[model samples]
Target: MPRAALPPVLGCDFSSSPSRRKPVVVAWGQLDAEAGTVALQGFHSFASLAQWQEFLQQQPAWVGGFDLPFALPRELVSQLGWPSDWQACMQHYASMARSEIRTLFKAFCDARPAGGKFAHRATDGPAGSSPSMKWVNPPVAWMLHAGLPRLQDVGADFPGLLRRESARVALEAYPGMLARELIGRRSYKSDDRQRQTPERAQARAELLDALQQGQHRLGLRLLADTAQLQTMAADASGDHLDAAICMLQAGWALAQHAAGHPLYGLPPGIDPLEGWIVTAPLSRP
Candidate 1:
């Protein structure tokens, strides 16, 4: 079967803190007909962890491209001396509050130098992601600390987690990795009413064009109509939409796993579930 006919379940735009900020919105699309090609299927915006949890409970299984880092490096895990096992380690980490995680990571970074404090993967910079464990700036470190625990609590069927005996929910993804390759340092989103400049709009438009053309190695194309791309670009806050596009890119990479990519893509000695991104089952536990 062709990639497009595989059923539409991937592509997610996430809010790192859905409980406080706007909900995570997922836009799903696929090639609809034999000749018509990719079409927008449906979109879902998750309001709360509970709402996402509910979705997971009902859906059982489908791939999603979420905006969160999928896994922390094994080197960092060992340095922290957290549980070596994935599940136990994540459970332990999840029990702590966000402030606690910040303190822990902050203390570690303080010991190192400003130049070498934060550990990084070879892929981090290309992906335009904050250090998976950094608490400051983008605060992705806290995000993993915040997001992973919830995934554990929900106990979705993560073959990746089960395989590694780690409950961390490991997923290897960074939409920016692909996005920047197409448009470098091009600002495409803003929450500030004053900063929504024409440059940003042009950036968004260019990105949409690139995606439709399959400019990235996605191999598959985004079969959106011109109107759809314009609508998505028009949203002043295209961050979520950009994230959704990234998610879709990641989803394509994931489907490739069936053919050759690593099923979990966890680094050497890392547990599978520790950082995987997944769709919430449609029903709640």
Candidate 2:
């Protein structure tokens, strides 16, 4: 089938509290899987969570990779006596305020050993994602709290979690997975303008070059015009490029689905209450 006939794909770098300065950035594209290419078309920045929700509601059918945890650690959930079932668990989690969550999670971490601070979902180990329970730094726990409820309310088909009748699909993604895979541990972005040094800009440029050259494990080329490429390179925040990384990861999973793996290459028997990160290997590849 022509790529146009397929649903549009997206990679979203979500923000728990978005403002005009730091909006939720999304990279929109179409994947030509057989040809092993992803055409990055444009970017969308939602200044508010409500604006992001509106976009999700309007998308009739699209496969998206979102940089947020879809679920929490099963260990954490069980220990807290939260609902074990995925949907029920989400509902229970969604009911809590951020302060309550931080307090409870802080208590949980405080009880553990010095090195072992937060609880980790299965996917975190393999994907190298920050623990979803971390309320500070990246504040991914807040991200999960903010993003997951919207996804649930939108009624998209969340593979391995909730398979709805709708064609809209969402998968957990970590842009760093691909970045680390291709570029090792080099830091490519920084939120602080002072930290966005020439070294980081060079690193971002190298990452874009690698992506365009299809030098990664997924064997997918990123198609972008000159201006778009420059824009991704120029953004010191790296949100734009992160969104594209997510889009490529989503495309890889979609390719897997097209080739007949129902889980979209996700391992069988993964913990449903702690969702898998798409394209993250169970071990180093």
Candidate 3:
């Protein structure tokens, strides 16, 4: 059978709050195969779940690389004695607020101070992400807690939760997963203008340069213009960079699709709800 056409591209800069005070930033693009066109479709800051839901309802066919942990480790779930099933597990997680989770993790950590505050997966190092269920630091744990439940509630097709087909695949992605591959532990973003020194500027420029030069395993070139780079640079929140990195991952996924890899070469058995990085597929000898 012939392969399906590549899915439309969606990238998100997630915010757990997602209220008017802290809206979720969504960036979407469409890749036109024949023309090799990757055009920005829209950017939205959704203040309510309904708004986000409405947005998803309109774009049901796009495969999105969202900057949120798609799942908590099964190890954490077994430790907490929560149900192993994805929907039930997320329901339990969605029941708790950020403060509640913070308190729970704090107590858990306090009880085992000698061991350390919280457990982490190996990907956390390269991805520069906090544990997917933790409340502090990068707070990605809370992002999964907040975001996955919504995805579950809406019956969104999370690659970790639902099976992958042709129309949509919601995968967990950290742009840092790609960025760290290029510049490990290098700081490329800062909210403080004074801290945005020449070094950091060069790092960002180099990162963009690498993408333009097709220097990564993805082997995809960024066709973004200088104006787009300036706009992405002006984003102090780091979401724009995250979105751009996700765009790179999306491009890589398209390439993988062309190579006839199932599920875009995503590893088998990643938490169906929690996602994984867009690294090079492990090679067969």
Kindly give the number of clashing pairs for every candidate.
28, 0, 9
Cα TM-score per model: 0.78, 0.97, 0.82
How would you encode candidate 2's per-residue C-alpha lDDT over 104-207 as one tens digit per residue? Answer: 99999999999998889888878888988899998999999999999888888889888888778999999998999878899999999999999999999999
Clashing pairs in 2: none
Model 3 ranges off by over 4 Å: 1-4, 18-23, 32-42, 47-49, 125-128, 164-166, 192-194, 269-275, 280-285
For residues 177-236, could you state the per-residue lDDT of candidate 3 as single tens digits?
677767767888875677877677677777877866667766666666677777666665
Find the 10 residues in a row with the least total lDDT in model 1.
276-285
Q: Write the per-residue lDDT of candidate 1 for residues 1-285, one digit (tens) a residue.
A: 646334344455556677434666666664333332344555567878677656645554455555666556566777888877777876777777878777777777789977898876444544556678876566676666656565555564344555433322224455565667679877777768799999988888888778777676555567666566666788767854565575465456445544565553333433453443332211221
- Residue 282's lDDT within candidate 2 is 86
Scored by CA lDDT, what does every candidate get? 0.59, 0.90, 0.67
RMSD in angstroms between candidate 1 and the native structure over all alpha carbons = 6.6
Error of model 2, residue 201, in angstroms = 0.2
Candidates ranked by TM-score = 2, 3, 1
Error of 2 at 226 (Å): 0.8
- Candidate 1's C-alpha runs over 4 A off are 1-7, 19-21, 31-38, 153-170, 258-285
As a TM-score, model 3 comes out at 0.82
Q: Give the number of the best model, judged by TM-score.
A: 2
How far out, in Å, is residue 192 in model 1?
Answer: 2.6
